[model samples]
Target: MFLAWQEIKKNKLRFTLITGILMLVSYLVFFLSGLATGLASLNREAVDKWQASAIILTDESDKSLYQSSMSIEQLNDIKAKKTAVIGQLNAIASNDDDKQNISLFGINKEEFLMPNVTQGRAFEKANEVIADESLKDKGFKLGDTLSLSSSDQQLTIVGFTDHARFNAAPVLYANLATFHQVKFGEAADQKKDQINGIVVRDDSISKLTQNDELDSIEIESFIQSLPGYTEQKLTLNFMIYFLFGISSIIVAIFLYVLTVQKISMFGVMKAQGISSTYLSWSVVAQTFILAFIGTTLGFAFTLVSGAFLPAAVPVSFDLTLMMFYGLILMVVATAGAVFSVLTIVRIDPLKAIGG
Candidate 1:
């Protein structure tokens, strides 16, 4: 460690440049991670808030919430500690000249799936609704009436709830009756009790996995089934893994070049009685030190940059996830230093010094 520190001190500019590159690479990884997480949360934030274990939809719905349709009687067959009926549809909510796309959800105000009102009281009557706070950006607020493009009916925003977005759109939560009215219009009464799916909690999920009539899927799987969700997640993860590879290569190349430049010095140290093992450890120590400093600074940069980002830009910084990545980076950096360590171990004192 002392030797590593001394070498870094002697080549401050060179080491600083190397550390800067690592820091930038780490920052890019962390920032992309935040964006990926934020996008995922936006796609499933409403469902996640339910804290349910599984969702039950008709077997033919292909695990899609929007495509599923079933009668309310299906709930009786589902034995769970907690269950909630849900109705969903896509619609544009417009107020005067302003308009926004949204996922309209129907749930009983009394159900556990109902979001807690953050700005006003929860909806208590038909046609009254609580919406995701994100709608506020589009000039929606308490008591504002929004017209649904799907039907002639309109709804009043009774309150706003935080983190209630779905599929990257704000959600409007209303009673099942209102949802039926909007979804079926003049035939509303005919499908008053129809539902998209059932959100279930605290049950042995495996029990319903093989049902002939319904598809029961874990919440995580349900989230992944969202349109384009799996593809988006896979793409971002590939980028992160690619960056990890690049990080390893960058560290290896820097350390290898530095080691080659100082071969004569290392030969002298070996001749003076330093063991190859000690010299190799010094290389590993240097890699760790540089990685630690770079990763920490990169994390700090991510936080500071996140703070300045606009609310419209989806970015959620999960500290635990970022920390795990940071640790992985450090490990990769150490792995990269192996080549340098091997070079140090193989140095022939006479040949190196004579050269």
Candidate 2:
């Protein structure tokens, strides 16, 4: 191990160059991982806030919530203690100077799915709306008024909630009556109540089985059907895994060339009574030291960038996921060292030293 450190110190330029490349690759991986996680959060945060075991969507919509419609009477057929009838739609909400796309959610304030308000108070009336905190970026604040383009109505921003985005758009929580009026243009006397779906409690799964018109899929499965959610996740995951494969190849090629360059030196060391096992262990230790330093630097950059980045760029990296990624990097780097160890093992001390 001492000899390996000594060699790295002596070959400072070569090692430094390789280390810089490793650092950049790792930084790319970490940044992309955070972005992917943040995007998925935008898709699922609203439903995830409910913590429901399953969601019931009408079978007629072909497993799509946006296309499914259920009447209030049909929703009453579900026996869950915490059933929440939900309606989702997309519309543009504009203030005097700005307009932003929003995913509107109609939820009963008393239901379990209502997110906790971060500012002001929750909506309790037909014309009031609670918005995701993300809207603060678009010049909205509590007590502000927003007009929806699809209806001749104005909604007061009563409150703001955190982490309530849906399908990459800020979510607006409104009363069921307001949603019906804005979505269907139906008057109160018409009695045409419709909802996208219902989220049910975990223990009520058996009770819901009796209904054949609704299909109970896990909340995650329902989220997967959201537009662009599944496709974006798959594309990001493929890039992350591809980056991992590139790291392995990069480390392996660098170490193999370094090993080949030092074949004669290894042979001389073996002829001078140095053990092959010690040489192999040193190779692994070198790999660990370099990989550890490089990945640590990359994550440091991620943290610093998070601090300075504007609020709009989502950076929600889970600790467990980051730890798993670091582990994978170290393992692949160590595996690359094994090739150098093989080269050391094959050194012919007698032939090389002219014995």
Candidate 3:
């Protein structure tokens, strides 16, 4: 510990430069991680709310909610502890000329999947709607009326819920009857009680899917199958993995070269009866200190940057995930320093000291 601190104190400039580089790398990795997490949440936010075990849809739809159609007959045949009918539609929610793309979810308010209202009362009448808090960014307000482009009926925002979104659009919760009316118009009777999917909580979900034309899939599988979700997550994760590799290489090469520079010093120390284990400890100590300082600086910068980041940028900052990332970085850094320790261990005292 003393040797490591002495070396760092003596050569402040080199260590400081290395720390700065590490800090920059950590910042990039953390920010990218946040973006990936945020985008994923946006993709599956509403479904995540269900906390259900399985979802039922027709296999013919190929896991697409928009294409899947389940009639009243199919819903009646299923048994569950609790179930919710969900009708999904893509439409423009317009307040006069102001328009925003939205995924309107028509839900049975009485069902277990119904979102809890945070700002106002739940929807109790036809044409009444509840929006995710995200819609507030688009100029929507409580009591604001938004017209679905396809329907003559106007939707009045009666409530707002937290963290409800699907496929990157703010969700609008409406009654199943109103949704049928908005989607199918006066001929809505033709599509009455039709639902895209059913979220069910049951222990016997596997048995429930034994029937042909109905399949029950885990919630995670359903989320991953959504368009662009898996692809985006893969691309972002690739970058994070690449950064981890780069961090390992940078720490290894830099420490290895620094150890090489101190070869003669190590030789003299060995000649003076110092142990290889102590010398190796010094090397690891330096690497750990560098990692600790760099990660702390990077974390601080990320926190400050949050205030400056725009709302449009989707970023999820999970403390547990970030801590895990930091821990991995430190471990990689320590592992990189092992090469330096080995170099010191192999040094011959007599040759190094030129006795």
Candidate 4:
């Protein structure tokens, strides 16, 4: 350990250069990780907040919650410990010709989870809407009337909530009846009681044995069926994995070349009776120190960048992921050191000493 430290101190420029490269690589990986996680959250924040153990959608819909429709009778047939009806629609909201695409969700006022009215009461009457804080930022205020296209009903914002977004759009909560009316227009009267699906709080229901043609699936299973969630995750994971592999290879090659250059020194030490085990430990210690310094700097950079970034840019840090990735970086760095140290054991002291 002492020898390793002395060597690193003697070659400050070389060591610093390697550390800088490592830091840059780690920074990219960490930053991309946060971006991926943040985007995923933005895409599915509303559904995640439901905290429901399962969601039931029409089997015939093939795992599409947005398209699946469950009649009121089917919802009643679902005997779960706890359940709530959910409806989803996408439409444009216009005020004075300023329009924004919005994701509209319908919930039974009695069973809605999350967004528990930070300002005003939940939707209690038809045509009343509770929206996210973004609405205020967009020049909307409580009691302000907004019109939905293709509908005669003029919706009124009744409340504002935080942390409520869907598909990257601010969520607007309304009563199932109103949502049905807005979505189906006149047809809503004949199917006023229907819902898109049932959100289950527990998994006590027996494997579905329904004779109806509709499909049923757990919430997670349903999310996996979304158009691009799985593919996006896979793509991000591949990039992260590739970065790790590159880091490992770069470290291994650098350390191996450095070790080869120090072969004579190692030979002299071994000839003086220094055990290969102690030398290997020294190499590993140096690797640990380097990785720790590099990754720490990288983490700091990520936090600083995140601080200065605008709110519109999505970047989030999950402590568990940070720790896990840190550990992975350490392991790969240490493995590289080990790969280099193996060459030390193969050194022949006699030839090194010119015997």
Candidate 5:
């Protein structure tokens, strides 16, 4: 460690440049990781809030909530200790010239799916709605009237709920009757009560028999089935993996070049009886020290960047996930130093010193 420190001190400019490169790469990785997490949350935040074990959907819906529909009589056929009937629709809410796409969820106020209002009170009357707090960014507010596109029905925003978004859009929660009216308009009374799916507890979900008409899907699977959810995560993860590989290559090339440049110095030391094992270990120690400094600075930069990012930008930092990735980076960096260590071990004292 002492010898490694001495070498770095002697070539401060070179080592500093290498450290800077590593820091930048690490920073990019962490930033992208946070963005990935934030985007994933937007895709499934509302469903996660339900905390249900599984959801019961029509077998023919292919695990997609949008395609599933069940009559009230079918809902009664299934039994569970905890259950909630839910309706879902993609709708545009407009206020004057301002418009935003939203996921309208039809839920009974008394059911477990009803999100607790964070601001104002839950809806108490027909046509009253509770919306995700994110809608505020689009100029929506409590008491604002939102007109449904293509329909005469209008809704009043009575409250705001935190962390209730779906498919990267704000969610609007309305009573079941109100949703039926908004969905069917004049035909609401003519059609029977129908819901998109049912939320059920994990243990209680087993009570459901393998009926030909209904299928039970785990909550995680349901989230994965959301449109673009899996594809988005796969794309971001591929980028992150590529960065990790690049980080390893950068460290290896820098260390190997530095070791090559110091071959004569190492040969002189070996001639004076310094062991090859000690010199090889010193190269590894330097790699670890440089990687530690770079990754630490990079993580700090990520935190600062996250702080300044606009709320409109979806980026969420998870300390545990970041730490895990950082550890993996450090390991890969140490592995990258293997070539430098081998070069140090193979130095011929007589040939190098004579040259």
Candidate 6:
């Protein structure tokens, strides 16, 4: 370890250049990882928050939540331990003549995973709505009237919530009856209580007794079945894997060539009775030092970048992924050091000493 430290200190310029390269590579990997996670969160945040174990949709709708529709009877038949109706629709929400495309979620006021009334009361009437704090930036406030397109029935912003977004749009929550009326117009009868699908708490329903008209799937499975979800995940994973491979190869090649250039010095040390084990430790210690510095810098860069990103950007930093990447970087770096040790073992002490 002492010898390795001395050598690295003596060749500061060369080691610095190599460390810089590794730092940049690691930074690129972490930055791309953040972007991938952010994009995925934006695409699936609302669905994940539901925390439902299963979902029931129409079998005739080709397995798409957007296209599936269920009647009151179809929803009730699938009820198990706990069930709630969810009505989804895409429409425009306008305040003060400024309009934006938004996803409308019709939910029962009594059931939801993370529903907290941050401000004002829950929807008490048919044309009331609650929205996220982000909507404030678009000119909406409590008691403000927002109109849904082509509908004479205007919605009042009764409350605000947090962390509620759907498919990159701010979610507007409304009572099931109002949701149906806004989406289906006068065709939706408030007295008859109809909804799009039923969210179930479990999936242990007997297959033989199940209704053939409705498709029941686990919530995780249902999210995976969404269009572009699997493909986007695959693309992000491919990039992350490629980055890991590139990091390993760069470290290995740099250390291997550095070891080769110092073969004569290692041979002379061996002639002086230094053990092969000691030389191997020297190489490993140097590799670990380089990896530690590079990875730390990369992590710091990610935090700084995240700070500057807009709030609407959905980057989420999970501790699990951070630890996983750190372990991976260390393992690959140690493997690179092993490659360098192999070259040291091949050095002939007698020739090195000119004996």
State the lDDT of candidate 4 residue by residue for 9-82, as single tens digits. Answer: 99999888778878888888888889889877766777777877777887677787778887867766666777
- Please give each candidate's TM-score: 0.96, 0.94, 0.94, 0.91, 0.97, 0.90
TM-score of 4: 0.91
* Reference-based lDDT, each prediction: 0.92, 0.83, 0.88, 0.79, 0.90, 0.77
Please tell me which model should have the higher lDDT, number 1 or number 3: 1
lDDT of model 4, residue 122: 75
Summed backbone clashes in each candidate are 0, 0, 0, 4, 0, 0
**Candidates arranged by lDDT, highest first:** 1, 5, 3, 2, 4, 6
Whole-structure CA lDDT of model 4: 0.79
lDDT of 5 at 82: 80
TM-score of 2: 0.94
The number of the candidate with the highest TM-score is 5
Candidate 2 local accuracy as lDDT?
A: 0.83
Clashing pairs in 2: none
User: Taking the tens digit of each residue's C-alpha lDDT, what string does model 2 give over 134-172?
Assistant: 899899988888888888778899999998887778999
Instruction: Give the residue spans of candidate 6 off by over 4 A.
Output: 149-153, 190-193, 203-209, 353-355
Tell how far residue 341 is off in model 6, in angstroms: 2.1
- Model 3 agreement with the true structure over 1-355: per-residue lDDT tens digits: 8889889999999999888888998888888888899999999999899898888888898888888888856877677777777888998889964788899888888888789999988999999998999888878899998988777989999999999989999999999999999988988988887889988888767765555888888888999999999999999989988988898789999999998888899999988899999999999999999988998898889878976988888998877888788888778877889789889989999988777
Candidate 4: stretches off by over 4 Å: 134-144, 149-152, 208-211, 353-355
Question: What C-alpha RMSD separates each model from the true structure?
Answer: 1.6, 1.8, 1.7, 2.2, 1.2, 2.5
Better of 3 and 5 by lDDT: 5
In angstroms, how far off is 139's CA in candidate 5? 0.8
Ranking by TM-score: 5, 1, 3, 2, 4, 6
